[model samples]
Target: MALRGLPTPLPGLAISSLLLARPAIAHDHHGGSEIPEGQTVSVEPLDTTLWIHIFVNMFAYGVIFPIGMITKSRWHVPTQIVGSMLALLGFFLGHAHGGREFVGNNVHGLFAHILQILLIAQVVLGLYLKGHWEKGINGFIRKLIRPCHSIIGKAMPVLSWTQMIFGGITALGFCQGEYTGQCAAHFIMGSAFIAYGILLTIILLVGQVWMRQTGRSQEFYDSAVIAAWGCVNTFTEHHWGTAWVRNDWQHTSMGIIWWCAGLAGIWMSRDRDGNPKRNFIPGLVIAITGWAMSSHPQELMVSEATHKMFGHTLMAAGLTRIIEVAFILGDKQSLTEDGRTWNSFQFLPIFLLYTAGFLFMGATEEQMLLVAGSDMDHVAYILILFSLASLVFLFANMLVHMYDRLANPTSSKEMNGYTGVNGRPMEEGRIRDAEEFELEGLTSDGEADDEGRGMLRRSQEGHRSQIQGVPLR
Candidate 1:
């Protein structure tokens, strides 16, 4: 199961890479009448400079920086330094691109300015932290700025995600007047699904200890978020004092189900003794929503087929989630005794949600109409979208595994029954190594008072304990 499920997202990437290498079909003009005036369709391929910029920044933000955030190895500093350099280079190429010019005030361009400023600030803070000042006003300033540096570093990837989305919208000239609401709904919801999948991945891989500490089942948080989102959707999806359209009715009903199911899920998230427990309400809600969406009315055949596929994919996600909980995991927190190993079937729901997100995001009315005009069938289009999903998932897993490797350098040998020079398991050696690293950084002078040393040791131990579960690699 692991072998089959793990490689699912890779074929999409391989196929999509080959497909993308082909020259884009040229259209005299963008096909849709809904296209806002002066907005250009992506009929032509992007300029070489823009393509280079996109890949460089994607590698930096999507790959390099994320791994850097999760590791505490000697390589962390150099990794971040390389990522920073690449980001700066990407920023330069973005401005220097000589492709077709945007006609209006470009949100992508405007947002780039803000992102660049944040990047510069992050780099400066990193330099200060690395400087390791421990005397005078410089030390005081560094202490004050340390937490801010960590916070900003963590936030950079999310901001980069938004900026990257804006870049795509800018290139394709989407999210304009009248289309803004649909565009926002599709993209934001799609991103939400993808984010949810990532969270699940994190938990499945290295979050078992954190889960135990929470004292609440994962469903508790999941249901709480669902209920909150449902409440917002129930009100915002339809305009007050206006006759409800078919879409408004359908959307509102889906929201109603979410909140109703969510409340039930939250209620069932714990056993009688107050211990965390699993429930099926969230997965049921997802399946029902998909069922409703599958038959969504659409004028174009392409739109109809695409919507059905999206709904089916979503339905698969929900059903697999149910299977994983009810059958595979038997409603337990984990399948393995130590909460380290997971059944491969666990990945089914995750990747399905991921695929469904891309499908829904790509099934927008304008995008569908465009595909229809280009003589492309729904199957081919959906496959291409799946390819994109697969590529993103592949990157996500790679980042997680890289972090696991760097953070628990000796875990593999320990798993294979190797002992270190001290006749201790390599896991113990890893903890000792980490303690020494932290002590070296925290205590500027080689010698510290016993009290200070004890505090630092406790702090390092606490940190290590939190992440002591199995490494994803």
Candidate 2:
């Protein structure tokens, strides 16, 4: 526990370093196993820099991007503006590491640099899109921007997450003179988050498409079951003690419970109709487990004050979703679907949870909380501010979608109902009286009715706004 140059991220400070029950602290805390004799670096961990850099990275990618993407509001470009600034700061600090970890025989320096260069390209491309080009070429540029923006946007975040995974394994690619290894638990949890993000995204995309076409809700059922198994793993597996591994043997028990519960939920969710929305246990399981996992209270209130509360927010969101379903509010769609709709409001808790996780990861690290930890604090503050700004946009979007965002409120199930050939209902001959069923939220021009008053109408945008005469992404 030597105090040297600049500090690094969570696990390395002189004071007791605790991150989610596992110590990601540098060398000396636990005499990690050594690499081959020829492969020891004289590098140091940039725990403090990482605190600000990586935390900001996650916040921008996980929270703000999604908000702007969903809403397409005036704040969208500004969100990118703030995000790009944070990224510059991160890259500056990341470069401060000076490739120390690769001084030894085993070098991952090349991989790290490649990732950084790619990130730079993504940022430049983003900025390029904001600038205007000549008219004839502008259309061509816009075409390029579409695929480029969409692909780079998706790739960068996943790549960034993967880098974090590597950083954890390599302890940010720097250690004193010797390094054994950081705890494997941290690695496992990071992997789990990555898995969670990817799965949630896939399920949401799938669910959105499926619901639009078939109107069956397989996404919710499957997601809930997965959440249950994860919950069982959390409660039964995490060995939470000041010291000792008492339940070393019980590691497999919770995993088994997870399996059984998931299988049972899936099997029982069926009523011989192959329908998915008949049961709500899967959603409940995910909600409860999310809350339960984040429920651990810290013994000390100094650094990680709202540590438990971070998890609680996500848990609360899940619970709110369940309530929405039970009370049969307008929130009856798949909870994790990424598409924007009124039902998406129920998914806000998960979004908040992800943001809060970024916040806690930044602010609570003992190293990040040290004297002169202002940079880390600033990064955390910016992240929060961006989120708050995004919230204004999100709240308005939510209000606009408070009723039947998922489907046309006036659409009849019987119209797209089970009455026709091959389950596809025929369109009625014609409307005898068009005004009799004019549709709930539309004008004759096919734009949302904006002249109306009320929260729903006030929040509604007749159409997406243009930036400098250009349509926004």
Candidate 3:
């Protein structure tokens, strides 16, 4: 009767079957029907102390050590050396701090970390062997170090790539984490450090290879000078936002220093001969442009009342221009007659480009200031000053060119022999005679022709007479 009231029970649905089905339906409802398989476990975060230690180690070993090897200033050497030592100390401290944490938290990771450290140490040692410890009592030590240094030097590119991969993995993990502030900072700083390390490694390798190829260890020093200048330029330009963080004094001072480096590099690379006048025009233009870009006062967008300035920009521009011009002139002066003409007008194109590019760049800066809600007065003032300076330099160069052209219209065709100061023929009669003698295959024995013979005999007689007149000791 109960089955009839239910209107039908399935043939397989007995009381036991119904009871078992109830439990299965309950399990499904409670999400216990199936278990997930092969899920990935999350990696634990690295200890903060360990991270900091690694950061410090990287800065010291990767940055400071390489810099010391490159820079060689008598006055600054002690300070740099001391700083490098301090960085090394910091590296060890950080490594110890991190190593302890790594040992406790990540037994397996500890070996990988150690391997990374060892590789980095190898690179640092190689750099030291190649530069800092190349000479003196440690020379024998260097001999032993050379094979390792060579191996590491070759492997640097690989190491750099590995670092990048690790850094990217870390960054990805950080991005996925809930600690937004800490993770973001970690990701940013880590990426930046990795990038910097890669660049440093590349620069070191390049410098080493360059030294080997040129057989000029001094070239490494020269590259260091360029790097120093670049750093200064970067600081002045506030490339890393240094200007925003630091006081004007710091930026200005740094800018000056960087300009000096550029100037020094230019001076060092100069052609041995002097004649900077022609080169000066282009140099002046570039200098003026650089100055306009860097130091000319422009109102800040955030604060119209405040002005943004970078003195180093102008200083670098000026010094670089002068140096470039001087080098050009020097090169021109040293050229053979055939090559001199080729180099003569080289400065002209450089000047034209400088003038055009700077003019455009300055104008762009002005527009940027305007968009930033800066006061037009400051912009106008800067524009005027920059334009005036540029014009003055341009006119001065033009005047010099005009004067040169006027003084010697046929200067180019004349094999650069038309010196305005001295209209005397560049090749004297003696030089012409020597050239003619060589062309004619004549000996100074009164032999080629009657005229040549007479001239040769007369020259001999005159020389003999002069010698005879001088009393013998």
Tens digits of per-residue lDDT for model 3 on 1-473?
00000001122122112112211111121223231232111223445655665565455444443343333223124534554565456545544531111111121223236445655566566456436454477778877776775565445433333343333333222222223222222223223222322332232222323323443323234334444544543443344544353334443444454455445544544335632213343234234433433443334542221122222333344464355335643523323423223343433333333333223222322234444564455456555535643653354344334333332233223343453335543333433444444434344222357787677667755754554465422
Best by lDDT: 1
Top model by TM-score, which number? Answer: 1
- The lDDT of each candidate is 0.73, 0.43, 0.37
TM-score to native of every candidate shown? 0.81, 0.44, 0.23
Superposed by TM-score, candidate 1 places the C-alpha of residue 427 at a distance from the truth, in angstroms, of: 7.3
Instruction: Show where candidate 1 strays beyond 4 Å.
Output: 1-45, 411-473
Model 3 whole-model lDDT (C-alpha atoms): 0.37
Q: Go through the candidates in order and give the clash count of each.
A: 0, 10, 2
Better model by lDDT: candidate 1 vs candidate 3: 1
Worst 10 residues of 2 by lDDT: 1-10
Residue pairs whose backbone atoms clash in candidate 1? none
Greater lDDT among 2 and 3 belongs to 2
Q: Identify the runs in model 3 with alpha carbons over 4 angstroms from their true place.
A: 1-51, 62-64, 67-317, 320-473
- Could you tell me which residue pairs clash in candidate 2? 7-48, 8-46, 8-47, 8-48, 9-47, 9-48, 11-25, 32-180, 33-180, 224-282
Q: What ranking emerges by TM-score with the best candidate at the front?
A: 1, 2, 3
